[model samples]
Target: MTRHKLGFWILTALVVGNMVGSGIFMLPRSLSEAASPAGVILAWLATGLGVLMLALVFGSLAVRKPELSGGPQIYAKELFREGSHGSRLAGFMSTWGYWVGNIAGFVAVITTFASYLSTFFPVLTSDKVWVDTGILTLKAGNVLTFIVCSLLLWGTHAICMKGMNGAGRLNFIATATKVVGFALFIIIALFAFQKSNIGPFLAPRTNDSGETLSLLSQVNAAAVGTLWAFIGVESAMVFAARARRKQDIRRATIAGLLISIVLYVGISILTMGLLTQHQLMASQNPLVDGITAVIGPIGGKLLAALGLISLLGSTIGWVLLSAEVPFQAAKLGVFLPSFSKENGKGMPKTSLWISNAVGQVLLLSTISGSISAAFDFIIYIATLAYLVPYLIASLYHIKLIWTGETFTTRKERVTEGMIAGLAALYSLWVIIAGTADLKTFLLGIVLIVSGILFYPLLFKKGKVRGTSN
Candidate 1:
């Protein structure tokens, strides 16, 4: 098992690949509805700085506490008093939220994949109904899309079950391909760029209800969508146990963040030069439209194919990540001990089944709506679940600095403090100000609070070691 460890590039690919998934392909349309060009710019800038700080904190902790193998769960749990209830609860709840968040990410990518596949088969998104009764109605297109998403989920699960090395190699190739593809599009968009398409850069965008949103409201509206693009920033830390070198985790994290930020900013902002806000907003696959405008119809087909490939690879990476959280947490005594089981190939068989099962349920929920609407709904819950762990990890980093636990160097202390401070503030800001709706936010809270029912299960068998978990 030790011989199959991941090197720096693969680790970096996980960070990059998981992040540059379906989010970027559909970003133009998502941002078009939420913000003007200026607001979009501000949202990315804020999210970039905030997530970078988080990457730094994760990297710093990897070096400072190599024993922390899992992501925020172990960090939040082990950083405090050993054998105490507080730390125990911290690890359990963090794992619960992050694990569920990972599942949401998996569903989001697969749903988008089906949406892009509609380029080849338009029926996938058609609202025409195939089956209906007085008691129930099922749109054939939605049913087909749901079937496509479920197949993708289980197919990716099968690949991961073979082991990480094979899945990682496939993901790395797809990541590289998408990066080149986006870079090519960015270059093409540059030559064909038009200032008028961008409209008034600072203009206030009107909401669908015919109400105009101010600049601040626009920024708030768009910030969460941008932040969602960078959701996999902690991929390296989550898989730290499989990383060949401790320092490589830090390098992979920072390198991945820089590359993804460039792609996200370029593809989103430059695409504005290719299509007007109204055109982009109406597009189901905005990148395809952007490319089609620049080069012709062939470009749309090529971009759609690329979107499928990108999301396919993203599914593999996120499945591995989501499964690992509970597997690692279980071994550390923070989750149910049964989750720690592994197959002959060193894959977490038990965790994979449970995680993907939850993902299946999420996919099933989308049958009542259009695939596009499902994407938005799933992303909201996923984003909200992800925010809590990020907040916990950031605050914990600051606490370590203040208490001089992670390191004692005074110069390093100030730098870490500043980074973690900004990260914590940004996490809080996104939750409080950038949320799309209050009901969805409360729904996420209910999901996290729901973990309490299972908390007592960990201690029933007395398997958790050295702490409260």
Candidate 2:
């Protein structure tokens, strides 16, 4: 019997749903704090161009190497000679980091879900401390937020366990609800928009240390936050084996990206027209706040509902994606054989559990800080983890062109070269700028480098692809 393959619409929904997650509802706050209006706008432009190149790379390679699935991390193998240790290790490490990053991405989604739900239940975002000790101080709101996040994560896991079809349908419904809801919000904002709220386009921003940031610094600061909005652009590529047509993988990626870019830009920019930068920077749910400022408190609740729906769909999509990565990598023999195990429903049960189990630990991280702070922490780590595979993939894209492996015409090679070049630089630039904070950077390094401990697991069964030993 043949497996039910995902068609363009389902594939596109998966890509869009994952990319348009919690970031959309909350990014206005992050961006406003990171940069002025001009810097934020420039950041989006730069991110859009760079991510398109990366998306194109996925599309180009998806068509050129039809057999390769599981996104650019799998393509990392080809960056080295076939059957070499470098090829196997590179692929394994890249997939490992990507998988870990994906787990954190799920945590980010659910944590933001809790944030939006806080709009209705103020306790979830409350700062009231119920217990304090020299070793630990516990806030009532943080504990409740953790509970909310964990329940949402596992509940999605349960639905996913029933089978992909059920989860896919559920995600599709949630995605549609958000698309319509946001469209309505944008229309309403247009009428209620106040131009005076936009303030100066390029006013200097002050950092937490009270230091004034230059324009370049502001753009650098906003780049990572903005790029987070597009982090899941490769969702369709990651599930390439399940695509009804290999070519649909490319189409779905580009289509999903264009869809998300429009929604993100509209929501991000239009909110500025509704609320002042200071108000936006302080808002936990900026979209809700923007809508509230426009219509009334009723608008805030409605947008909050939209955020919950959007985040619900995103959580489902990313959880599916994160599990699929390990399962696909294991099938390709780059990950542990345990992850390749599937249940009666043809789902990666083991991989799903392990991935969510790690995410459960990550959810605990929200128990001590503000919800937005926790969201930022997890997303930073995830974005860092994700950029490694992206940089590796961009380098591999360049390598293919350099060796004349995928193209025939000089024009084709030159075109692919420029795309690969820009993507590689973008990846490197974000990695540098995002890691400027030593503590978070070091924390991200520790999580990724910890993958080395499990590196030996790749060969424990002596089954890793290209393993010669």
Candidate 3:
């Protein structure tokens, strides 16, 4: 039987769904905490341009390197496929880094989902428990929340296991719901706009010595926080193999990216206008809070419902991507062979199960405490982890341009070269911004270094295959 493939619209939904996750919902508050209104706007403008360039680079690669599927991993593998051990290690690192990042992202998504659900079902947000076993005391609320998260994770897994077409259709529904919901939010915010709320737009905070931070420093500080809103801009390129028309991958990526930019900028700017920086910083769910302050409690609850829908869709999209990356890598002999196994529908059964299992472990480990704190920690690390693939892909684009591998004309080469250069520099800037916290920086380094252990196993598998063949 032939497998049903994903089409242009579904692919587009995947990009939009993955890019507009829980980050956008809470990012207004997060950004407000770090920068002034003017600084936040500057940060968005900068991040928007940089992420757009990266999206275009991915689109260019999809068009030019149609044979190289499986996202950035294939780029690393093919670029270094000269049989040197160092080259092989580089390829494996790209794949491993991407897989690890997605797993961490999955944890962050589900945790956010649980947190949003807590708005309605306060039990999920409760910290106290009836039982107190010394070794493994379980909070009733947390256990129930975990059950709900696990169900959503595996339930989406079941849909994806049916086929790409089915999964993509489900994603389209979820994406459409959230898009409409966010549109309503933008409308309400605009109607409730207050000019006074947006004043002191460049309010730079003072240090302990009473020295205010410079405008440039304030904008720089907001870059990483705003960059989170554009994390999955390359979702379409990752599933290139499943796309019915390869060109659709490029169109879908650019289209989805433009849509996300509009939504993100609109929501952030409008929410800033609706509430003062103090109000935004104090609230956990700033979108909901802004709506509530403007209209009433009903408006806030509606926005909360919308957030839940948005996060659920986003989580589903990432889960599919998380499985696809490793499955494709395993087929190319980078990951373990088990990951290559697929069900009758051509879905990566083993990879899906493994990815969700890891997510489950992370969810259980982190959900024991404050959900918000856990989410904040996971998202910061996940964001850092993602920078690796973004940087590698940008460099790969530069390499292609230098080798004239994808350039058709002098003008094309120069334009792409400039875009790739800017993208690489922007990725570096975000990575540096993410590393401002020394402890988080060290943790990221440790995670990257830990990928080394899997190399020996991959080498042993290669030798066995060589002998068998």
**Better model by TM-score, 2 or 3?**
2
Per-model TM-score, in order, reads 0.96, 0.96, 0.93
Runs of candidate 2 with Cα error greater than 4 angstroms are 1-4, 466-469
- Cα-based lDDT at residue 211, candidate 1: 91
Give a tens-digit lDDT track for model 3, residues 308-385.
888878888999999988887776666667887899888899999998888888888544666666766777777787
For each candidate, what is the lDDT? 0.87, 0.87, 0.81
Clashes of 1: 1
Candidate 3 lDDT (Cα, whole model)?
A: 0.81
Off by over 4 Å in 1: 2-4, 206-211
In model 3, how large is the Cα lDDT of residue 429? 90
Candidate 1 similarity to native, TM-score: 0.96
Candidate 1, 1-469: lDDT as tens digits: 6423999999999999999997898778888888999999999998999999999988988888777677865777865687688878888888998899899998999988998899889888777877888667789888998899899999999999999899999999999998998899889998988889989888778866789999888988888889889999999998888888889999999999999999999989999999997898888788888888888889888989988888888999999999999898888778888999999889999999999999999998668887667777777788878888888888888888998996869999998999999999999999986455767778888888888889999888567766422
Query: Residue-wise lDDT of candidate 2 within 54-79, one digit each (tens)?
Result: 99988888788767777678877777
